[model samples]
Target: MHNFLRFFPVFASTLGVVLAVPLNVSHTTISPAPSPTCTEATTTALPPEQDCFYVPPNGWETKEPGAVLRHRFAPQQPFATDTVNYPAWNILYRTTDSNGDPTYAVTTAFAPKDISTPHAMVSFQFNYNSADVNESPSYGIYHDIKPKLWISKYLQHGWFVNLPDFEGPLAAFGAGHMAGYATLDSVRATLKMSQIIGMPRGADQGVRYAMYGYSGGAFATGWAAELQPTYAPDLHFEAAGLGGLFPNGTATLEKLSKLQMSNWAWSSNLRSVMIGLGTMHKKIREVITSSLGKPEWDWNTVIRRLPQEKEVSRLDLKNAVNTAINSPLVRNVLDYDTTLGSHGIPTMPLMFHRADTDQLSAPEDTQELKNVYCNSGASVFLHVHPNTWDDPHFREGLQACLSEDIQTFLATAFARRLYPGCGTDNRPWGDHQYGPIGAR
Candidate 1:
């Protein structure tokens, strides 16, 4: 039932950069490494020259978005050195930023070994919430121990799986427009790369594709789906599987600020969001640092861990908090422009899922997104777990259930059929027998 290309092997190589830094004796300051090495990717047949994986080669920058700047034949050999890697190509491609300025992004493209299953490509956006480009999926999957390990399950199924580093070069983590642009360009580049590589011959043109992500991942997918019609009309994305989508950073920040210290356990995620904001807007860094000055609540620690939302809520520093909130940098950076209905509606089917009760984030985030898209004439199926409400522990279970549902919907979507269509949220959560919840 499966095709085995015994001849194709993935050779492991360093990604050339690291996200974490080593500290000196004081344990207070981080010192950059003495030498930053250029990572050179390689396989059994071809070897990539040493250079920053993202930097474009000569003349590649002049091309349009989706043009392949460079590529490396590297495979994810996580467990051991000799284990066979599912054939994949790490690609750097030209794309645009939120401002429509030329930039570059990266993606990892792969397909079924069998290559004869009426091929479709599923661009799975990786939710890497950091300010470092080295932390992108293509680089982290090969280097970091915790880069969305669940994507491995996709390899077992026979389809093209493309993972895009939606955060552009500056690592503007929360800029939805940039995320969307990079994702669309990743698909564009992959279409061309697929044909040149000849994995599933002719997969380069007119192939129906699906998009998927959760939380930060959904940021990219959500924007891409919204921007597709106006920005990249040629893409045929039949369906998008989105979950835990927080479209506006300002809304999330306001919610966290209002919560009391009793709900501080989820504050670390707030810190992570702040890190993303800081990456995109440098002017807010000092204000943010002062706001998060407490021990154990520092930006760096909370970035690595979770913070207490009550402490971060700033009820005590009323005037100062208000000033920070109203600052130009904060307003400009967290602006919900080009998100959801602000642009154009997605013509494709959308499976939007949200947790009934999440202490770290508001359920209204997804609900609001659904409302806007639906009002704009987009076909959307919203899934809310009736039974899972108020259970903090259900987060993991919720994601797993959503992942399964997305895959199930993709089966129908790729067949050129609309997935259960709009207003179809009767499907049962986790059980799959028509209960409640809809992840596109």
Candidate 2:
């Protein structure tokens, strides 16, 4: 593994940011609109803000979770390749929210033209890192080239790729259970609609599924893994690759508040998190307003708006972050909702990796989670990258994408192999089931 690190390409450039443009989109249900007609000219056209495909039909809640509500041939966006060879579809499905209430979400499925029998499937979560529904991969995937390239790699391997907007329609970004439900339901929708999405017959049963996510994406993946045992017991994952895992919400906010002075970007991220969390938990809004006194702005309305809106002043952002961190009521809600590892240990094997010096998510938190899983008898392989750069958070994330370690881990898991060369100086700890190579 160390030898592979030297060959990884340097990705010093930052990812492209999706410009936030406010739109008049509604999350509530409306009268059903006609189905979309997918002509060659309309295939590449972006979905309008009021695209009826997103609106759940009346009585949609009566359907079971993971039931396909609507689906359309999606635009081959973020990639200018031939749609015939790499077809994609947008699926709106019924899923539960953080409160376990019936809700709806969307996911994009990409597949190779000729899928092999008993092929592999990868649920690749993208790190959109925003609290805006417009920034979701289903709509804004065309803005970033990195996610497109990653999706293409999986397609090149003849694996179906499922990209879920795990934040749901409300864009409740930091709500762990909601993200988990959406992620798992997206997979369910893909498998349930296998034939509709052009998969070979009986493909669902023979498909070997794995998941990969980094940074904010990892937050969703981690939560889904933890919640899969009870929340979605019908589903099973061959392996899960979680890099730069966000373990504790409170700890993360405290770390960001301390670093916000040096990097204004960190302050922006702090504000986004607060808004994301506030969307799902009313306690967060109540505590912030009570601790800081009623602000000139309406907390309820503000939480519904986009995070990048200038309506929120810098002073308000600072005060909200401080109140969220200090107030016991807000902290309790965050501890229960935003944190990972409290739910349950995943049954599938996990490949965990992170930089030794990640600024956003502390290294100790990842190690602590690994300890919890290992102690619970779960198969886990923990890899710690060397802190060679100033911004290990970004550099290590790029390394995860550039290196073949994740692919190798998934392949080993798909093959039901016990060891995938996980033991080394860099990877000092793994569960007994996946012991060090050559230790049998």
Q: Give all TM-scores, in the order shown.
A: 0.75, 0.84
Model 2: how far residue 400 lies from native, Å = 0.9
* Per-model root-mean-square deviation over C-alphas: 8.7, 5.5
Local accuracy of candidate 2 as per-residue lDDT tens digits, 192-259: 87887766545355788889988888888999999999989999898898888769888888787776
C-alpha lDDT of residue 318 in model 1: 33
Task: Kindly provide the TM-score of model 2 when superposed on the true structure, using C-alpha atoms.
Answer: 0.84
Model 1 earns a TM-score of: 0.75
Q: Which 10-residue window in model 1 sums to the lowest lDDT?
A: 21-30
Off by over 4 Å in 2: 1-44, 76-78, 82-85, 114-118, 201-205, 290-294, 300-316, 419-440
Pairs of colliding residues, candidate 2: none
